[model samples]
Target: MRNHSGHDQADHEGHGGAQPGGLSVSEHGYTLEFDSTILTAGVQPVSFRVIGPDGQAVTEFLSEHDRELHFIAVRRDTAGFQHVHPVMDEKGTWSVELALEPGDWRFFTDIHPVGHDGTMTLGIDVAVAGPYDPRPLPEATGIAHIGEYTVALDGELLPGEPSELTLTVSRNGRPVADLQPYLAAYGHLVALRVGDLGYLHVHPEGEPGDGATAPGPGIAFMAVAPTAGTYRLYLDFQHNDVVRTAEFTVRTATAAPKHAERHHGHHAHH
Candidate 1:
């Protein structure tokens, strides 16, 4: 596993010393320029573009995860998460329709420019004008139910450490073994820290055709929490040719002290 700190440091430097992903609208020399930042509450079309350093909308991009770009939309309170791909025009403007409610929304674009070193996630906030009533975040849990499917999470997140997370999918108490490949994998996981919505786009441990990886009920991923905090996880899996997302609220576990023997000795003496 790659060290979180080291990876973050490299990202910081590579993105012209900007803050982490999903925290800024502009990074390095690219900017997320939206056509409008205010919209009506409901399903509406939104348009935006990634303006490159040359002051033009970027038209050339390298595909990542079977697409040139990935778009994510979530409310400010970490509710109403939607992962959708936008259709980019020849002029570099991308458009997509989103089912937005009466609240503040954050839109993130995960993209890799042709000459960029790595992928970059850029975020912008939009306001849907209406009577906004923010809902409290759901309590931390290991299980989430989506329609007829139930996803059970079996793993613990340790602060600043790479942890293995396995999510098993079942429908009506039966394991789903004939899972279809989505984005070249059995699943795609996106982790966002609660307060700041720090974005982490994580892929599954193994590919779909790999001999060791099973297509069945369990999808594994290695995720690193930047700190000890509450985070919201979204898992997009495909079955029966339809993509569905399972959401979970997870809190990082604090690591134990390393000098336990010395501390016990002091207490015994006392």
Candidate 2:
């Protein structure tokens, strides 16, 4: 068997990787960029950065809280799953020694400030080649705000069917398109298959919402749950002078397509 370092040694510590009070990718748009191939086991490492709106750095380390950068990697088919912590070598260059199989994979980072409500984020798709994208957004139907940063969602879910999760993001009760580069990407979206806490990393196709236009009606990346489960959804976005956290619980569609089976830990019910 080959040894891979999807997550670091520190990641598998005290609280089963997912901690109670720490950084857990609360927001969306934590940028993930690097050569998928790790040239050296010890030297040739991965590189990337995450910036905050206040012109500060949103680090993976949340000592005042808990874990540093909480990263979740799941293949499009949900077959390959990695819950690893990339060591921040530089400003935003988080490095890890995980050899990934040739396939389309998505990376979502949960970032937060210790002792504060500032949770910044981003998501990126890793292909051997090509620019990133989200062609069309999932259509948002019964939208509600359960008091996070923006809107809360009320939708349907099914097993073995492709389902779209339409999301609307805004601040101060208005569309927040012109959302600045939070973390390193535009916006961030994370979807967990309800009960078992399966992970889905969803990214915005286009730039964030402009103050002129509505922030979203931004569709989240699509996914299908292996088994019917109650999913919890969390989104992180930043604009103006504040960072917003929008959260909700959703059930996968009954007609949801069939994807690979991936397992995850319990939700950190903050």
Candidate 3:
């Protein structure tokens, strides 16, 4: 397997190999260029392009989970998270509308070039001009309520290991059995480390059309935390033909030490 940097996955064997997200606007010879870095506080249109290693706008990209590009915008205070798909023109420029608020906002573009070896998530921060009152991050919890729906998260996130997470959706104290498929799965999850909003990839356990995967009250996913830290989770699901997102804050468990292996290796050297 290959990492976002086009390097062998082995490089990240014991730790995170790829550069931390939201720290740079470019990586792996690819650049994320925005039309304007400053904007007013309100709904506006944003545009950007991905420059390939050849210094030209990358016009071709493979669709991931039925989307060419996944654009995520979140406030620096871990608030106002939005996940939307942008349409790319022939010139390789992608444009999308966003509801902007005052404060520093981070933009993350998740894409995979047609011939690229692996998926890359490039991010940049933009300034929104206005009175900014940053909100505090909600306490870590396993339950989240959005509108009339309540989502119960059951799972533990362990550092360096894939942890199984199951989210059960309900409404009016009853299980929701008519969950619709979104992004080829019963639910789509995106995890971001709290402090820097580092993008953490969360994989769905199965597909909606798969005979074994049911579209019902429970959605299963495998999430691997890069390190032991607080993470914000955004779960996107569809019901009644409308898409809604449920947010949760979770802290990852500490990684177990490999003490026995280290002790044996130390003795063998003597």
lDDT (CA) for every model shown? 0.82, 0.46, 0.80
lDDT of 2: 0.46
Local lDDT at 124 for model 1:
93
lDDT rank order: 1, 3, 2
What is the total number of backbone clashes in candidate 2? 47
Q: What tens digits encode model 3's per-residue C-alpha lDDT throughout 199-230?
A: 85444666777788777799887556677789
Candidate 2 lDDT over residue span 1-270, tens digit each: 000112321232111123211123323333334545222222234555665445445554463123576666544444344545677755656766455555565565655544434433345666533333422322334454635445645345555443555566654576655665654334455555532344544454433333433344454444343456565455666566555556555655554233322211223332
Better of 1 and 2 by TM-score: 1
Q: Give the TM-score of candidate 1.
A: 0.88
Off by over 4 Å in 2: 1-149, 152-155, 207-219, 256-270
Name the Cα RMSD for model 2: 19.1
- Identify the candidate with maximal lDDT: 1
Deviating ranges (above 4 Å) for candidate 1 = 1-20, 256-270
Count of residue pairs whose backbone atoms collide, per candidate: 0, 47, 0
Better of 1 and 3 by TM-score: 1
**Residue 229, model 3, lDDT:** 87
